[model samples]
Target: MDKFPIHIAFNFVFLRKKITGIRVHAIELFRALEEQKETKYIFHVITTKEGADILNEHGIRANGGIKVHIIASSFEKETDRLKLQLFSLNNTLKQNRIALLHCFDYLTPLQRPAYAKIIATIHDLIWLENPNTYSLPKRLFKKVFFSHSIRKADALIAVSKTSKESLIQHYGHGYDQKTTVIPNGLRNTFLTIKKQGNPERLIKGEYIIAVGRYLPHKNYERLIKAYAHCNTKAQLVIAGSDMDKSVDLQRLAQELGLNDKLLLLKNPTDAELISLISHASLFVMPSLTEGFGLPLLEAMSLSTPVLCSDIPVLKEVCENAALYFNPLSIEDMAAKITYALNSSPILQKLIENGHERVQAFSWENSAKQVMNLYDDLLLNY
Candidate 1:
């Protein structure tokens, strides 16, 4: 008998983990399905009402007669949370004859025993590498559960080669055969804003931009300190949500005497973010670690000159398209910021190269590759 076309159930167990990157991934996955008539596919976005609302706002609702499955699990403890996730997913799996189950969370495979292809995307390596990044008890539980999940997954996806290496080094004790390297893609808004170049939103080319949640790994402190010491001509506009409630970063900015220079615009809209990046003199990502820095690509796609930490993931993603700065060394960040502010010719060259580099990564391309993977699994399973 001829093989049946693959059907994917994208299990988003933790919808609040939703961010710009995940949104782009989902949209692209659906768009690719729409275009590929030979390879018939269906997407069951297993999320909550809030998650569905986010997708709807982004204009990715129920395309091609696809439906979003809203799953609810009322649990407060870590152990209970895992159990609920497993139970909810078990029900989802039994209800749908899904050929492949791809999940952003770790417990999808543990719950669904029926799927021929079980894949999980490991979006970050911090849980294994740096336990302190998470709460003590939560980290302990995650280490065990995440390790178990990886071993159980029929396939594991690492968003970047660095992320792949990190997974292998940390969790490849018995799951080496299951891992695959697939880079994340930037959203269409990135390309759209670049093409249209909305003048009203564009700055008069007087500021530098930094984007990311105010998390420790983002290293916003270093950026603020560096900006304080760097050339004074350009203001530093920091855009993103303050996911952490501490407001320690805000205090740090004030302490550095950068109160007037640092602009903290929290959780700006996509249009606002695009406008910020498109007009900035430079885009700085001082993140100490990332699975794949999507913001790096987003900024680069908008033809913004970028300066990121010289970490493996950022280097792999940005190549020579960005200026590299030492994440920990505030002095080095300061020096690079100074150079970027002072050298117009160098910055212009970086902008041009950035535009060229970003073209290589697209949501449609990523989704198509994922579909191909799904079809391959179904055919050869």
Candidate 2:
């Protein structure tokens, strides 16, 4: 069988099938490719049931205007799941015409001998940081899988300059030749939705909004405490799917006597989220670590002024377009919130700046870069 020039299959080895940052990138890339009628490319995605469902909901499939393949497998352990994914991708490639394999993570042993030119996108530098953040078994697993993935990938695409630097620091190779920096693209739907719901609700009160999964890394616990010290009239609304470990955060909110002021909403629709972000007096991100913070851009695209942590990656993404608050200092966070609440002029300027800055990034532009990269690699081969 003659392989197509851009028959690329992306593999993200996992059984959880969460629509995380990696999955979002995969979907957006395909969406961008599908829009270009002149490009003859087929982007197949091998994932689990949940991932397939997500793509299906977005109308992306092999039969639905874009070429996508969903390889389903069930395995409990991470290593075994990866091994299963490797075997599946290998079988799929053998039966079909595939020239490129763009894997989100590293390939397993079964995929190593395949003839496809591989391009791997590293979503984070998880291995560079201390392993003590997770349990003993997880630490051991990271030591194996993360290290192996980086070593084996033909071309490494980092989602941000920070991630690229972290990869060079940890892997000791692929700094110049194989590694490339491509920032994560923002979805346009966040800005397209016209904010029209209850006008009465809009006039209810001014509040700050924070959105993310209820994970420890998001540092919502600290955010709630920090918000407690803000103006009594200004409320903080934390919205996300309550994770397995988020019960502690809820308890912390109660302990801080913020049961009424702090609102916890679970898994809101994108429209609802956008409304919240658009109407928010301030959008804050107090994450301890992030590969690329998508919410910061989403808020900015909605013309919402952002108050994010003073972390390097956040600063890199937000630039001088956002107001920064020290993540370590509750005093600083509270003060920023207070300042925003007290000054209408500052709020207007920040929102304008945020809107202007976020215009530079788009899913279409990201997709174009990825497609062009594919063409270049194919020519080289």
Compare the candidates by TM-score and give the number of the best one. Answer: 1
lDDT of 2 by residue, 327-372 (tens): 8788888888888778888888888888788887787887777777
Superposed Cα deviation of residue 58, candidate 2 (Å):
0.7
Q: Tens-digit lDDT track for model 1 on 1-381?
A: 224544567765454433655555555555555566353556667766666666677565665646578775333444654665566666776676666787764565466645447887777777666555678887877777787778778787777888778877876546566777767777766666667755355555489899877667888877888888886778888887764463776798778887777778867878888888878888999988887888888888777899999999998998989999899999999999898878989998898888888877876677677666666667764
- The number of clashing residue pairs in each candidate reads 0, 0
Alpha-carbon lDDT of model 2:
0.72
Reference-based lDDT, each prediction: 0.73, 0.72
Give TM-scores for every candidate, taking all chains together and pairing residue i with residue i.
0.90, 0.89
